[model samples]
Target: MADYLGMLKGEQLVSLSENFDYVTATADFVGLKLFPAVKTDNMKLAIAQLTKGGKIPVMALVHALDTEARIGDRPNYETMNVELMLIKEKLNQGEAIRKLIRDTGMKETESEILKAVFNDANNLISRVLTRVEGM
Candidate 1:
Protein backbone atom coordinates (compact mmCIF):
# COMPACT_ATOMS: atom_id res chain seq x y z
CA MET A 1 0.00 0.00 0.00
CA ALA A 2 1.17 3.50 -0.77
CA ASP A 3 0.64 6.65 1.18
CA TYR A 4 -1.39 8.76 -1.21
CA LEU A 5 -1.97 12.49 -0.91
CA GLY A 6 -5.51 13.52 -1.67
CA MET A 7 -6.45 17.08 -2.55
CA LEU A 8 -10.05 18.19 -2.63
CA LYS A 9 -10.97 20.09 -5.80
CA GLY A 10 -14.57 21.31 -5.80
CA GLU A 11 -16.60 18.09 -5.75
CA GLN A 12 -13.71 15.84 -6.82
CA LEU A 13 -10.90 14.41 -4.74
CA VAL A 14 -7.71 14.05 -6.75
CA SER A 15 -5.44 11.42 -5.21
CA LEU A 16 -1.77 10.96 -6.10
CA SER A 17 -0.09 7.78 -4.97
CA GLU A 18 3.61 7.40 -4.27
CA ASN A 19 3.63 4.03 -6.00
CA PHE A 20 4.25 4.18 -9.75
CA ASP A 21 1.99 1.23 -10.47
CA TYR A 22 -0.87 2.80 -8.53
CA VAL A 23 -0.48 6.10 -10.36
CA THR A 24 -0.28 4.37 -13.72
CA ALA A 25 -3.38 2.34 -12.99
CA THR A 26 -5.29 5.45 -11.91
CA ALA A 27 -4.18 7.33 -15.02
CA ASP A 28 -5.16 4.38 -17.23
CA PHE A 29 -8.65 4.30 -15.73
CA VAL A 30 -9.32 8.04 -15.45
CA GLY A 31 -7.41 9.28 -18.52
CA LEU A 32 -5.51 11.71 -16.27
CA LYS A 33 -1.81 12.05 -15.63
CA LEU A 34 -1.23 11.45 -11.96
CA PHE A 35 2.18 12.80 -11.07
CA PRO A 36 4.40 10.60 -8.96
CA ALA A 37 6.96 11.78 -6.41
CA VAL A 38 10.03 10.47 -8.17
CA LYS A 39 13.24 11.74 -9.70
CA THR A 40 13.00 13.60 -13.03
CA ASP A 41 14.55 10.69 -14.93
CA ASN A 42 12.22 8.16 -13.33
CA MET A 43 9.25 10.45 -13.87
CA LYS A 44 10.02 10.69 -17.58
CA LEU A 45 10.27 6.91 -17.83
CA ALA A 46 7.00 6.51 -15.93
CA ILE A 47 5.27 8.91 -18.27
CA ALA A 48 6.56 7.04 -21.28
CA GLN A 49 5.53 3.70 -19.79
CA LEU A 50 2.04 4.95 -19.01
CA THR A 51 1.67 6.26 -22.54
CA LYS A 52 2.90 2.95 -23.92
CA GLY A 53 0.34 1.19 -21.72
CA GLY A 54 -2.49 3.09 -23.45
CA LYS A 55 -2.81 5.88 -20.89
CA ILE A 56 -3.02 9.33 -22.49
CA PRO A 57 -0.56 11.79 -21.01
CA VAL A 58 -2.45 14.83 -19.80
CA MET A 59 0.87 16.58 -19.08
CA ALA A 60 3.57 16.91 -21.71
CA LEU A 61 6.71 16.56 -19.61
CA VAL A 62 6.89 15.83 -15.90
CA HIS A 63 10.22 17.59 -15.34
CA ALA A 64 9.24 20.67 -17.35
CA LEU A 65 5.97 21.32 -15.55
CA ASP A 66 6.20 24.11 -12.97
CA THR A 67 3.43 22.69 -10.79
CA GLU A 68 1.70 19.35 -10.35
CA ALA A 69 -0.88 18.75 -13.07
CA ARG A 70 -4.09 18.65 -11.07
CA ILE A 71 -7.36 20.52 -10.58
CA GLY A 72 -6.70 21.80 -7.04
CA ASP A 73 -4.29 24.43 -5.79
CA ARG A 74 -0.90 22.91 -5.04
CA PRO A 75 0.24 23.27 -1.44
CA ASN A 76 2.90 25.93 -0.84
CA TYR A 77 5.30 24.35 1.65
CA GLU A 78 7.03 27.59 2.60
CA THR A 79 3.75 29.39 3.22
CA MET A 80 2.44 26.43 5.19
CA ASN A 81 5.55 26.32 7.41
CA VAL A 82 5.31 30.07 8.14
CA GLU A 83 1.57 29.85 8.88
CA LEU A 84 2.10 26.84 11.16
CA MET A 85 4.72 28.77 13.10
CA LEU A 86 2.38 31.75 13.39
CA ILE A 87 -0.46 29.57 14.63
CA LYS A 88 1.84 27.99 17.25
CA GLU A 89 2.97 31.45 18.40
CA LYS A 90 -0.61 32.65 18.68
CA LEU A 91 -1.66 29.57 20.63
CA ASN A 92 1.28 29.93 23.01
CA GLN A 93 0.27 33.57 23.62
CA GLY A 94 -3.32 32.50 24.44
CA GLU A 95 -4.65 34.42 21.46
CA ALA A 96 -7.82 32.99 19.91
CA ILE A 97 -10.67 33.89 17.59
CA ARG A 98 -13.20 34.03 20.41
CA LYS A 99 -11.07 36.57 22.25
CA LEU A 100 -10.74 38.66 19.10
CA ILE A 101 -14.48 38.53 18.48
CA ARG A 102 -15.25 39.52 22.07
CA ASP A 103 -12.76 42.40 21.95
CA THR A 104 -14.30 43.62 18.68
CA GLY A 105 -17.85 43.45 20.15
CA MET A 106 -19.31 41.34 17.37
CA LYS A 107 -23.09 40.71 17.26
CA GLU A 108 -24.31 37.49 18.93
CA THR A 109 -25.14 35.58 15.74
CA GLU A 110 -21.95 36.71 14.01
CA SER A 111 -19.91 35.74 17.06
CA GLU A 112 -21.46 32.30 17.11
CA ILE A 113 -20.70 31.72 13.44
CA LEU A 114 -17.13 32.93 13.85
CA LYS A 115 -16.69 30.68 16.87
CA ALA A 116 -17.92 27.69 14.88
CA VAL A 117 -15.55 28.49 12.05
CA PHE A 118 -12.62 28.83 14.41
CA ASN A 119 -13.49 25.57 16.16
CA ASP A 120 -13.54 23.75 12.81
CA ALA A 121 -10.24 25.34 11.83
CA ASN A 122 -8.62 24.26 15.10
CA ASN A 123 -9.88 20.72 14.63
CA LEU A 124 -8.45 20.60 11.12
CA ILE A 125 -5.10 21.92 12.36
CA SER A 126 -5.04 19.31 15.09
CA ARG A 127 -5.75 16.53 12.60
CA VAL A 128 -2.97 17.76 10.33
CA LEU A 129 -0.55 17.89 13.23
CA THR A 130 -1.46 14.37 14.23
CA ARG A 131 -0.86 13.08 10.72
CA VAL A 132 2.50 14.85 10.56
CA GLU A 133 3.52 13.36 13.90
CA GLY A 134 2.54 9.89 12.71
CA MET A 135 4.67 10.34 9.60
Candidate 2:
Protein backbone atom coordinates (compact mmCIF):
# COMPACT_ATOMS: atom_id res chain seq x y z
CA MET A 1 0.00 0.00 0.00
CA ALA A 2 1.16 3.52 -0.68
CA ASP A 3 2.28 5.32 2.46
CA TYR A 4 0.36 8.48 1.50
CA LEU A 5 2.61 10.37 3.84
CA GLY A 6 1.85 7.72 6.49
CA MET A 7 -1.43 9.37 7.39
CA LEU A 8 -4.24 7.02 6.40
CA LYS A 9 -5.07 3.45 5.55
CA GLY A 10 -4.48 2.67 1.88
CA GLU A 11 -8.13 1.89 1.20
CA GLN A 12 -9.36 5.10 2.78
CA LEU A 13 -6.91 7.26 0.91
CA VAL A 14 -7.75 5.56 -2.37
CA SER A 15 -11.44 6.17 -1.89
CA LEU A 16 -10.83 9.82 -1.10
CA SER A 17 -8.60 10.10 -4.13
CA GLU A 18 -11.28 8.63 -6.37
CA ASN A 19 -13.89 11.00 -5.01
CA PHE A 20 -11.99 14.05 -6.26
CA ASP A 21 -9.95 12.57 -9.09
CA TYR A 22 -11.21 14.80 -11.87
CA VAL A 23 -10.70 18.11 -10.10
CA THR A 24 -7.38 17.05 -8.67
CA ALA A 25 -6.12 15.84 -12.00
CA THR A 26 -7.17 18.94 -13.84
CA ALA A 27 -5.77 21.17 -11.14
CA ASP A 28 -2.50 19.32 -11.39
CA PHE A 29 -2.41 19.52 -15.17
CA VAL A 30 -3.11 23.23 -15.09
CA GLY A 31 -1.02 23.89 -12.03
CA LEU A 32 2.05 22.43 -13.67
CA LYS A 33 1.84 25.03 -16.40
CA LEU A 34 0.27 27.99 -14.66
CA PHE A 35 1.09 28.16 -10.95
CA PRO A 36 3.72 25.54 -10.44
CA ALA A 37 5.47 26.62 -7.26
CA VAL A 38 2.40 27.77 -5.39
CA LYS A 39 0.35 24.68 -6.17
CA THR A 40 3.26 22.41 -5.38
CA ASP A 41 3.84 24.00 -1.99
CA ASN A 42 0.18 23.72 -1.04
CA MET A 43 -0.04 20.08 -2.05
CA LYS A 44 3.21 19.18 -0.35
CA LEU A 45 1.98 20.66 2.89
CA ALA A 46 -1.28 18.79 2.54
CA ILE A 47 0.33 15.39 1.96
CA ALA A 48 2.97 15.77 4.60
CA GLN A 49 0.31 16.68 7.12
CA LEU A 50 -1.80 13.70 6.11
CA THR A 51 1.11 11.32 6.50
CA LYS A 52 1.66 12.58 10.03
CA GLY A 53 -2.01 12.87 10.86
CA GLY A 54 -4.91 11.31 8.96
CA LYS A 55 -6.49 14.40 7.49
CA ILE A 56 -5.65 17.51 5.52
CA PRO A 57 -4.73 20.83 7.04
CA VAL A 58 -8.03 22.38 6.11
CA MET A 59 -8.31 24.95 8.87
CA ALA A 60 -4.83 26.34 8.49
CA LEU A 61 -5.18 26.73 4.76
CA VAL A 62 -8.56 28.34 5.23
CA HIS A 63 -7.15 30.70 7.78
CA ALA A 64 -4.22 31.54 5.59
CA LEU A 65 -6.42 32.14 2.60
CA ASP A 66 -8.79 34.20 4.64
CA THR A 67 -5.92 36.35 5.74
CA GLU A 68 -4.72 36.68 2.21
CA ALA A 69 -8.14 37.63 1.01
CA ARG A 70 -8.49 40.21 3.74
CA ILE A 71 -5.17 41.73 2.90
CA GLY A 72 -6.07 41.93 -0.75
CA ASP A 73 -9.31 42.91 -2.43
CA ARG A 74 -11.63 40.31 -0.99
CA PRO A 75 -13.85 38.29 -3.23
CA ASN A 76 -17.30 36.94 -2.46
CA TYR A 77 -17.06 34.93 0.73
CA GLU A 78 -18.96 31.93 -0.58
CA THR A 79 -16.86 31.73 -3.70
CA MET A 80 -13.67 31.74 -1.71
CA ASN A 81 -15.14 29.13 0.60
CA VAL A 82 -15.84 26.89 -2.36
CA GLU A 83 -12.36 27.33 -3.66
CA LEU A 84 -10.93 26.45 -0.25
CA MET A 85 -13.14 23.38 -0.06
CA LEU A 86 -11.80 22.07 -3.33
CA ILE A 87 -8.31 22.71 -2.10
CA LYS A 88 -9.11 20.87 1.13
CA GLU A 89 -10.45 17.92 -0.79
CA LYS A 90 -7.39 17.81 -2.98
CA LEU A 91 -5.21 17.85 0.10
CA ASN A 92 -6.98 14.81 1.48
CA GLN A 93 -5.74 12.53 -1.27
CA GLY A 94 -2.18 11.32 -0.77
CA GLU A 95 -1.16 10.88 -4.37
CA ALA A 96 -2.80 14.02 -5.66
CA ILE A 97 -1.42 15.99 -2.75
CA ARG A 98 2.02 14.58 -3.42
CA LYS A 99 1.95 15.45 -7.10
CA LEU A 100 0.70 18.98 -6.47
CA ILE A 101 3.39 19.68 -3.91
CA ARG A 102 6.15 18.04 -5.92
CA ASP A 103 5.21 20.11 -8.94
CA THR A 104 5.14 23.37 -6.91
CA GLY A 105 8.73 23.25 -5.66
CA MET A 106 8.43 24.46 -2.06
CA LYS A 107 11.34 24.51 0.35
CA GLU A 108 11.66 21.92 3.10
CA THR A 109 10.88 24.30 5.95
CA GLU A 110 7.72 25.60 4.35
CA SER A 111 6.56 22.03 3.91
CA GLU A 112 7.48 21.26 7.48
CA ILE A 113 5.47 24.21 8.84
CA LEU A 114 2.38 23.12 6.91
CA LYS A 115 2.71 19.54 8.15
CA ALA A 116 3.15 20.76 11.68
CA VAL A 117 0.18 23.09 11.44
CA PHE A 118 -2.08 20.16 10.63
CA ASN A 119 -0.39 17.44 12.62
CA ASP A 120 -3.71 16.52 14.20
CA ALA A 121 -7.33 17.61 14.16
CA ASN A 122 -7.03 18.93 17.67
CA ASN A 123 -4.12 21.10 16.72
CA LEU A 124 -6.18 22.61 13.95
CA ILE A 125 -9.12 23.12 16.26
CA SER A 126 -6.90 24.72 18.81
CA ARG A 127 -5.59 27.13 16.24
CA VAL A 128 -9.11 28.06 15.35
CA LEU A 129 -9.92 28.53 18.98
CA THR A 130 -6.96 30.76 19.51
CA ARG A 131 -7.83 32.81 16.49
CA VAL A 132 -11.42 33.09 17.59
CA GLU A 133 -10.39 34.10 21.05
CA GLY A 134 -8.23 36.83 19.67
CA MET A 135 -11.07 38.18 17.66
Candidate 3:
Protein backbone atom coordinates (compact mmCIF):
# COMPACT_ATOMS: atom_id res chain seq x y z
CA MET A 1 0.00 0.00 0.00
CA ALA A 2 2.16 2.81 -1.23
CA ASP A 3 1.16 6.19 0.08
CA TYR A 4 -0.31 8.11 -2.83
CA LEU A 5 -0.84 11.27 -0.87
CA GLY A 6 1.18 14.01 -2.52
CA MET A 7 2.87 17.02 -1.06
CA LEU A 8 0.30 19.56 -0.04
CA LYS A 9 0.90 23.27 -0.08
CA GLY A 10 -2.49 24.61 0.95
CA GLU A 11 -5.66 22.51 1.22
CA GLN A 12 -5.05 20.55 -1.96
CA LEU A 13 -7.98 18.11 -2.13
CA VAL A 14 -11.51 19.40 -2.76
CA SER A 15 -14.77 17.53 -2.00
CA LEU A 16 -17.82 17.40 -4.32
CA SER A 17 -20.48 15.62 -2.22
CA GLU A 18 -23.72 17.57 -2.74
CA ASN A 19 -23.36 18.37 -6.39
CA PHE A 20 -22.40 14.82 -7.21
CA ASP A 21 -25.48 13.22 -5.61
CA TYR A 22 -27.75 15.84 -7.11
CA VAL A 23 -26.41 15.22 -10.61
CA THR A 24 -26.26 11.45 -10.33
CA ALA A 25 -29.46 10.75 -8.42
CA THR A 26 -31.57 13.33 -10.19
CA ALA A 27 -30.13 13.90 -13.65
CA ASP A 28 -28.58 10.43 -14.04
CA PHE A 29 -25.50 11.89 -15.74
CA VAL A 30 -21.94 10.65 -15.68
CA GLY A 31 -18.84 12.81 -15.80
CA LEU A 32 -16.31 13.16 -18.63
CA LYS A 33 -12.51 13.50 -18.50
CA LEU A 34 -12.27 17.26 -18.86
CA PHE A 35 -15.11 18.33 -16.61
CA PRO A 36 -14.51 20.76 -13.78
CA ALA A 37 -12.83 19.34 -10.66
CA VAL A 38 -14.75 21.31 -8.12
CA LYS A 39 -16.52 19.17 -5.53
CA THR A 40 -14.66 15.97 -6.40
CA ASP A 41 -14.74 14.70 -2.84
CA ASN A 42 -18.45 15.24 -2.62
CA MET A 43 -18.84 13.12 -5.72
CA LYS A 44 -16.60 10.43 -4.32
CA LEU A 45 -18.42 10.42 -0.98
CA ALA A 46 -21.80 10.16 -2.65
CA ILE A 47 -20.69 7.05 -4.50
CA ALA A 48 -19.32 5.56 -1.31
CA GLN A 49 -22.65 6.17 0.37
CA LEU A 50 -24.38 4.31 -2.43
CA THR A 51 -22.02 1.37 -2.02
CA LYS A 52 -22.98 1.22 1.64
CA GLY A 53 -26.51 0.57 0.44
CA GLY A 54 -25.23 -2.45 -1.56
CA LYS A 55 -25.14 -0.52 -4.81
CA ILE A 56 -21.77 -0.26 -6.46
CA PRO A 57 -21.86 2.97 -8.39
CA VAL A 58 -19.41 4.05 -11.07
CA MET A 59 -17.98 7.54 -11.42
CA ALA A 60 -17.08 8.79 -14.89
CA LEU A 61 -14.90 11.78 -14.12
CA VAL A 62 -11.34 11.66 -15.45
CA HIS A 63 -8.27 12.92 -13.65
CA ALA A 64 -7.73 16.53 -14.54
CA LEU A 65 -4.76 17.21 -16.85
CA ASP A 66 -4.41 20.88 -15.98
CA THR A 67 -4.28 20.82 -12.19
CA GLU A 68 -0.70 21.92 -11.99
CA ALA A 69 -1.19 24.89 -14.25
CA ARG A 70 -4.08 26.00 -12.10
CA ILE A 71 -2.15 25.26 -8.92
CA GLY A 72 1.11 27.00 -9.73
CA ASP A 73 0.69 28.76 -13.03
CA ARG A 74 3.36 26.45 -14.41
CA PRO A 75 3.50 24.38 -17.60
CA ASN A 76 4.23 20.64 -17.96
CA TYR A 77 1.85 19.49 -15.28
CA GLU A 78 1.06 15.90 -14.42
CA THR A 79 -2.50 14.57 -14.26
CA MET A 80 -4.03 12.99 -11.17
CA ASN A 81 -3.87 9.36 -12.39
CA VAL A 82 -1.58 8.14 -9.64
CA GLU A 83 -3.95 9.49 -7.05
CA LEU A 84 -6.98 8.08 -8.85
CA MET A 85 -5.31 4.66 -9.07
CA LEU A 86 -4.55 4.85 -5.39
CA ILE A 87 -8.17 5.58 -4.66
CA LYS A 88 -9.28 2.75 -6.93
CA GLU A 89 -6.87 0.42 -5.15
CA LYS A 90 -8.37 1.42 -1.84
CA LEU A 91 -11.82 0.60 -3.17
CA ASN A 92 -10.54 -2.82 -4.19
CA GLN A 93 -9.01 -3.35 -0.76
CA GLY A 94 -12.25 -2.58 1.07
CA GLU A 95 -10.83 0.42 2.82
CA ALA A 96 -13.24 2.94 4.21
CA ILE A 97 -14.14 5.76 1.85
CA ARG A 98 -12.70 8.34 4.19
CA LYS A 99 -9.38 6.50 4.20
CA LEU A 100 -9.11 6.92 0.45
CA ILE A 101 -9.62 10.65 0.77
CA ARG A 102 -6.95 10.82 3.45
CA ASP A 103 -4.45 9.28 1.04
CA THR A 104 -4.87 11.12 -2.28
CA GLY A 105 -3.67 14.38 -3.72
CA MET A 106 -5.63 17.44 -4.77
CA LYS A 107 -8.60 16.97 -7.11
CA GLU A 108 -10.31 19.33 -9.53
CA THR A 109 -13.28 21.46 -8.57
CA GLU A 110 -15.20 22.10 -11.81
CA SER A 111 -15.01 18.63 -13.32
CA GLU A 112 -18.43 17.46 -14.58
CA ILE A 113 -19.55 14.14 -13.17
CA LEU A 114 -20.87 11.87 -15.89
CA LYS A 115 -23.36 9.13 -15.11
CA ALA A 116 -21.79 6.09 -13.43
CA VAL A 117 -25.05 4.13 -13.35
CA PHE A 118 -24.26 1.95 -16.36
CA ASN A 119 -20.71 1.23 -15.34
CA ASP A 120 -21.84 0.43 -11.84
CA ALA A 121 -24.51 -1.94 -13.08
CA ASN A 122 -21.98 -3.74 -15.26
CA ASN A 123 -19.60 -4.11 -12.36
CA LEU A 124 -22.34 -5.59 -10.23
CA ILE A 125 -23.01 -8.21 -12.88
CA SER A 126 -19.38 -9.31 -12.92
CA ARG A 127 -19.15 -9.40 -9.16
CA VAL A 128 -22.29 -11.47 -8.85
CA LEU A 129 -21.02 -13.87 -11.47
CA THR A 130 -17.76 -14.30 -9.61
CA ARG A 131 -19.56 -15.01 -6.38
CA VAL A 132 -21.94 -17.44 -8.01
CA GLU A 133 -19.08 -19.35 -9.55
CA GLY A 134 -17.28 -19.55 -6.21
CA MET A 135 -20.40 -21.12 -4.72
| Estimated TM-score for each candidate | 0.21, 0.18, 0.18
lDDT of 1: 0.35
lDDT: worst 10-residue window of model 2: 80-89
Question: Model 1 misses residue 91 by how many Å?
Answer: 21
- In model 3, where do residues sit more than 4 Å from their true spots? 1-112
**Clash pairs detected, candidate 2:** 5-51, 7-51, 40-101, 40-104, 44-101
Give the local distance difference test score of model 2: 0.39
lDDT of 3 by residue, 1-135 (tens): 123223232232233222333233323222322332343543222121222323444344555776543232223333332232112211232344324344542244112111222134345444543443343
Ranking by lDDT: 2, 1, 3
User: Top model by lDDT, which number?
Assistant: 2
* Superior by TM-score: candidate 2 or candidate 3: 2
TM-score of 2: 0.18
Error of 3 at 1 (Å): 31
Q: Candidate 2 on 1-135: residue-level lDDT in tens?
A: 233335444664465545543333334243345533333323222211223333434333246543554343222222111122221211243565555445654355444534432344444334443443343
Question: lDDT of each structure?
Answer: 0.35, 0.39, 0.32
Off by over 4 Å in 2: 1-7, 10-119
Of the pair 1 and 3, which is ahead by TM-score? 1
Which 10-residue span in candidate 1 carries the lowest summed lDDT? 1-10
Q: In model 3, which range of ten residues has the least summed lDDT?
A: 109-118
